[model samples]
Target: MATRLELALLSARGVGKGIRLLEYVGLVIVLAATLLAGGHEVWRMFSSGKVGISDLLLLFMYLEMVSMVETYWRMGKLPVRMPLYIAMVGIARHLMADSSYHDPWLMIAGAGAIVLLAVGVFIVRYGHLRFPYTQASEEATDRE
Candidate 1:
C-alpha cells in the first residue's frame, strides 16, 4: 500500500516518461521527413541537367536541420548555437536565391539577420564557457 505522496510521485513519473516517449517519436518523424526531402533533392539534382544555386542552398538547409536533430538526439540536449547557425545559413541562402539588384534594402535586411544570428552564437558560446557547471550537476542530469 502506498501513501498519497507516493502515488502522486508515481503518477508524475509516468507522465514524464510518456512525454519523453512522445518527444522521441516526434524527433523520429522529423528525421524521416528531413531524410526523404534531402534524398528527393539529390535525386532531382542528378536527374536534371543543371543544379542551380537555390537547389544547393535548399539541400544545405535540409542537411543542417538533420545535423541539428542528430546532435540533439545524441547529446540529449540541444545547443543554442545550432539553430543560430542554421538561421544564418538560411538567411544567406534566401538572400542569394531571391535577391534582385533593384532592391538593395532587402539584401541589407537579410545580411543584418545573418549578423544578428552570428552575434547570438557568440553570446551563447561566451556564456557557456564563462559559467561552466559543476560535475555534480552533470551527474544528476545523467541519473535523470
Candidate 2:
C-alpha cells in the first residue's frame, strides 16, 4: 500500500516523464524541419547557379540549430551561447538580405548586438572553465 505522499511523488514523476517525452518529440521535429529547409535552400542555390550572402547565412543558421539540438541531445543541456550565436547570424542574414535597412544607426545597433553576444560567449566559456562542476556537486544539486 502506498501513502498519499508516495502516490503524489509517483504522479509527479509520471508527469515529468511525459513532459520529457514531448520535448524529445518536439526536438526531433524541429531537427527534421531545419534539415528539409536547408536542403531546399541548397537546391535552390544549385539550380540558380549563384550563392549569395543570405543563402550562406541561412545554411549557417541551419547548421547551428542542428548543432544546438545535437548538443542538447547528448549533454542534456544547451549552452546559453548557442542561441546567441544563432541570433547573431540571424541579424547578419537580415542585414545582408534587406537592402532598405541601410541606415547607419541600424547597422551600428546590429553590430553592437553581435559584439554583445560575443562577449556573452566569452564570459560563459570563462566561467565554465574557471568554476568547473564536480560529480559530488552534481549529486548534491540533484538531492536538493
Candidate 3:
C-alpha cells in the first residue's frame, strides 16, 4: 500500500541495484579476459623462447587494461585517460609489430593517433587538476 511517489522511488532503487550488479559482472568478465589474454601471451613468448618489442608492448597494454579495471572497481568511476593510455599503447604495439609491411602513410597515421591520445590524456589530467570533482559531488552523482 504505497503511494505513487514511494512506488517510483522503490522502482528506481531496484533499477539502480540491477545496474550496479551488471557493472560488477561486466568488470569480472573484463578482468578474467584480460588475465587470460595476458597469460596466453606469456605462454607464447615462453614457448617460442623469444620476446620482441611488440610482444612486450602487447603485454604492457594488457597490464594497463587490468589496471584500468582495478581503478574503476576501487574508485566507482573511471578516469577518462585510462582508455587513452591503452589506445596509445595499442597503436604503438601495432606500429612496432607491422612497421616493415605497413605503408608509410599508415604508419604516420598510427603515430598521429598515438599523439592525439597523449594530448587527450594531458587535457584530461589538466582538467582534473584545474577543476577537480569534489567528493560530495561525486557521491551525489553516484547515488543517482
Candidate 4:
C-alpha cells in the first residue's frame, strides 16, 4: 500500500510538471504572437499618413500587453493591476480621440471614471508591494 501511494504521488508530480511545462510553452507562443501583431500594427501606422490619437493609444495598449507578458515570464505570475491600468489608459485615449463626437457630459464622466480607475490601480499596486504574501512552510504544506 505504501508503494502504491508513493507511485501515485510520483505520477501526480509528473503530471504537474508536464502541465507547468505546457503553460510555459503556451506563454512563449502567446508572447511571440503579440509581438508580431504589435509590429504589424506599428508598421501599418507608419506607412499610413493618417495617424491619430486613437492609433497612438492602440500602440500604448500593445506595449502594455508586452509588458504584462514579460512580467509574467519573469515572475511566473501576473500582476493584478496591469489590466486595470491598461483599461484606464484605453478609456482616456478613446475620449481624447473622439472628443468632438461625444457629448460634453459624457466625456467628462468618462474622464472621471478613468481617474477613479487609475487611483484604484495605484492603491492595489501599493498594497500588493507593502503587504506581500510570503510562502512559509505551513502555507506551502497547506497548499500541497
* Candidate 2 segments exceeding 4 Å error: 136-144
Comparing candidate 3 with candidate 4, which one achieves the higher TM-score? 3
Q: Candidate 1 or 2, higher TM-score?
A: 2
For model 4, the local distance difference test gives 0.84
Name the better of 2 and 3 by TM-score.
3
Q: Clash number for model 3?
A: 0
The C-alpha RMSD of each candidate to the native structure, in angstroms, is: 2.5, 1.9, 1.8, 2.9
User: lDDT for model 1, on a 0 to 1 scale?
Assistant: 0.85
Query: What Cα-based lDDT does every candidate model obtain?
Result: 0.85, 0.90, 0.90, 0.84
Model 2 lowest lDDT segment of ten: 135-144
Clashes per candidate (backbone, < 3 Å):
0, 0, 0, 0
Model 3 lDDT per residue over 1-144, tens place? 899999999999999899989999999999999999999999999999999999999999899999999998997788888888888988888887875738988888888898988988998899989999998988898776
Tell how far residue 18 is off in model 1, in angstroms: 0.4
Enumerate residue pairs that collide in model 1: none
Q: Provide TM-scores for the models.
A: 0.87, 0.88, 0.90, 0.79
Any idea how many clashes model 2 has?
A: 0
Best model per TM-score:
3
lDDT value for model 3 = 0.90
